[model samples]
Each structure stands twice: as C-alpha cells, then as structure tokens.
Target: MTERIYTAGLVVIGDEILSGRTHDKNIAQVASWLQVQGIRLSEVRVVPDVIERIVEAVNALREGYDYLFTTGGIGPTHDDITVDAVAEALGVPVVVHPQARAILEKYYADKPGGLTEARLRMARVPEGAELIPNRMSGAPGIKLGNIHLMAGVPHITAGMLDALTGTLEGGAPLLSETVGCWTPESEVADILRQVEQAHAKCQIGSYPFFREGRVGANFVVRSTDEGDLKSCVDSLCDGLATAGFDFTPGGI
Candidate 1:
C-alpha cells in the first residue's frame, strides 16, 4: 500500500525577529530546501523569546506534522532560550551532552579566547536528545522527539540542516506547471474557478505581471499527485486556448 505523506511545519523564536531588529531569511530558505526534497511547508510561526510561547508552538506543530523545525534562540547569548523551551515542551530537564561539548571544544581549540562558559552553554541539551552538527559554528544544535532545534544565524542553521537532511523523511514531491494569460485576472477568474473545481486536488494560483506595454497573468497549477497535476495543467491550457488568450507553456 502507498503511504500517506504530508507536510512539515516551522517555529522560529527570537525577540529580535518580533521586534523587527532582525529580518528572517531561514524560513524561506528551509521552505525551498524542503520543497526540493518532496516535503511541503504547511505552516510557519514566529514568536518573541518568551519560553511559554515557544513551548506552545512547538507542542502544537509537533502533533500536526511529520516533522517540526525550530530555528533561532539557540545561541549562548543571554536571551537565547530555545533549549529551555524545547525541554519544557518535551517535559524533560535540560543538561549538557558530553559529545556535543567535545565537538565544540575541538572546534574552538585553535582560537586563543574560545570556549568560554558562555560558549559552553551551547552544549546544553534536553535529556535524551541527539545533536545536530553545526559546521559553521562548533556549537551543535539539538534534536528531541520530532523537533529539530537549530541555530538562528542563516549560515549555522543551513549547515545544521545539511547535516541532518539524511535523517529526514520526505513526502511526495510537489509538481507545478504555469501558463501565462494575455487577459486580466478578472477576465480569467471564472475560468480559473472552473479549473479548480475540476482539479480539486491541485492548487491554482494566479500571478499577475506587467511588461513593456503588455499586462498578463500566470496561472500556476500545483499538486503532489503527478497525474492530477498534469491533467489540471492540460485542462487549464486548453481553456486558455479556447478563450484565445496568448499563453506561455512552462513547468515550475
């Protein structure tokens, strides 16, 4: 029997993000990566550094998705509290992992002023969790239950994701096809609605664009099932041809 596969959710926690001090680039990057691996990003939420909020979001998403990824609030800085929040969510105590500390120690061995108490704090993990290797920074990320906790910085988080990718399971790859319409969105709105009803499993999105003295819309059809995806795209193109709308054919 074919297994039912679904999407992943994300929770990014940090005061800097909520206060507008730091712009988040990790969510989009991770989303794109997961897409290539056949996993869809179903939801993403950002919260302040409050521990309770982090715990709440993690607990909620963990129950609903195949996997949960949390980036940010894992640093050694004073306000970094991802470890504690993850521990609280798992109902466990936070403690230092010797293997994680050894990795950090080796990473900082050559530096004259490295591996301070503050830096050692990065080794703290919720009891009975595994480490997510960080190539950018020596301090590793931790994974407990279904939650893959990661660093906030884009580079480190990306490295951790790379290290952990082999351990992840992906669902059906999302497929897409796009057709450009010479007509306005409103002119094609009714046709698009009919196409959606006909291909109920596929998602239809219209993107409007303007060029040199020309305006048009791109109707994109996406779905996890390849047969449904292609059928919907073909039907959409046929509809556009019937309406005499100038259209471009391409896959995304």
Candidate 2:
C-alpha cells in the first residue's frame, strides 16, 4: 500500500524578518520539528506585519496543506496582530481563553508588572482554539483545527514544538543518509542523478562546500522507506567508487 504523505505549510509573520532586522529561524526549526513528526514542510511564506497580508497567507496556506503553522506577531506589542489576522482568516472572533488567562495570571502573579492588559494579550486566541504550552515564556502557542500559531523566538518555538510532540497525526518519518566526498559536486552530478533515477522512492540532493583549501560535496539521499534509502545510498557509493572518487561514510 502507498503511504499517505502528510504535508504542512509555514507562515512567517513579522516585519523584522522581511526588513532583515531579525533573521528568521522559525522556518528551519519548524521544518525540523515537522520532519520528526513525519510531516513534510511543503511550503513557506514570509509576510510583513500587516494584518491583511497575514490573513491572506494564513487562509491560503491553511487550505493548501494538511496543517498550517504561523510564527511571530503573537506578542504583547501593539504591532503584534497574528491572532487577530488568523481569527479574521478563519471568520471567527478573538477572545481571551480562560485557561490561557489563568496560566498567564499564575505565571506572572509574583513577577513585576503582574498580568497587565498588555501581558494578558498573549492569552487571546481565535475562538475555539486550544493552547500549546510554552515553557520559556508565560504565553502559550495557539492551535485551532489544523492551524498552529507559535512564537517567533527560536528557543520559545522549540519549547512549543516539544510540547506538541507525539500529538499530531502523520505518516512515516522521512529518513536520510549522507555521503561526503572531497571532490567538486559537478564531477559526481551524473552519478547522483543515475542513482536517484534507479531508486523510485528516493531523492538525492548534492550540496557543495569549499573548505580547507579544497572543494567537497555532500550527497544526501532521502526516502520514507529504509530499504529504498539504503539501496540508493549503496548505489551512489558504488558509482562513486567506480569513478575513483574518495568519499566519506558521513558528510564531509
């Protein structure tokens, strides 16, 4: 039987990311987390802090993939509008979730500036959304149906991802094997292509690097099937050996 492929889309929402002020790390972090969950991060869209753009991206992505995740614009600041945008996209109203508010109140009860209105803003969510715990901060992530709203900070996002582990439904996790060689990627292009072609369910990616005054390349083979992945890697290694290319077992 053919395994069903589960896919996800990511919307990176922040003016800082688009303006280059803050480098966006959520894309890679989310992609890695989804990979472990056996879900493919199929597409990503970065938009400014504008609500209209965010709403458009959110609606479009949520419809196109099995799951949709948004990062950024969920903070306490006035410019933070991800929740509002998502609510608009879903045609729902925003409300302060009781549990979320209680969490924030408890988290900030002893701290300075305890649970002010600004801080309470973190507790707001689109109607009927559930909370994803955030251990790094008082605020929690939001989940409504297949849509997930996460924090922009990498470490905070990591915490949210950890909380969501083993909760999402997915297919087989994609597996990968890497082979490195101290040769230019151009030299092994044909070998890579031929091996990938021979493996129906496998894909080969060639990444080139220059280091230690030498050109090197790493070939990555990815597949959902372990046997197919190993077969493709073996075929690639064999072809490289036949061509007299010295390669390493793992990436160089």
Tell me, by TM-score, which candidate is best: 2
Which candidate number has the best lDDT?
2
lDDT of 2 by residue, 127-193 (tens): 9999999999889999999999999999999999999999999999999999999999999999998
- Tell me the number of clashing residue pairs for each predicted model: 0, 0
Error of 2 at 124 (Å): 1.0
Among residues 3 or more apart in sequence or in different chains, the pairs in candidate 2 whose N, CA or C atoms overlap within 3 Å are none
- Score every model by TM-score: 0.91, 0.98
Q: RMSD to native for every prediction?
A: 2.1, 0.9
Model 1, residue 108: C-alpha shift (Å): 1.4
What is the Cα-based lDDT of residue 200 in candidate 2?
A: 92
Candidates' lDDT values, in order?
0.86, 0.95
Off by over 4 Å in 1: 1-3, 209-215
State the displacement of the C-alpha of residue 35, model 2, in Å, after optimal TM-score superposition: 0.9
Spell out the clash pairs found in candidate 1. Answer: none
Q: How close to the true structure is residue 171 of candidate 1, measured as C-alpha lDDT?
A: 71
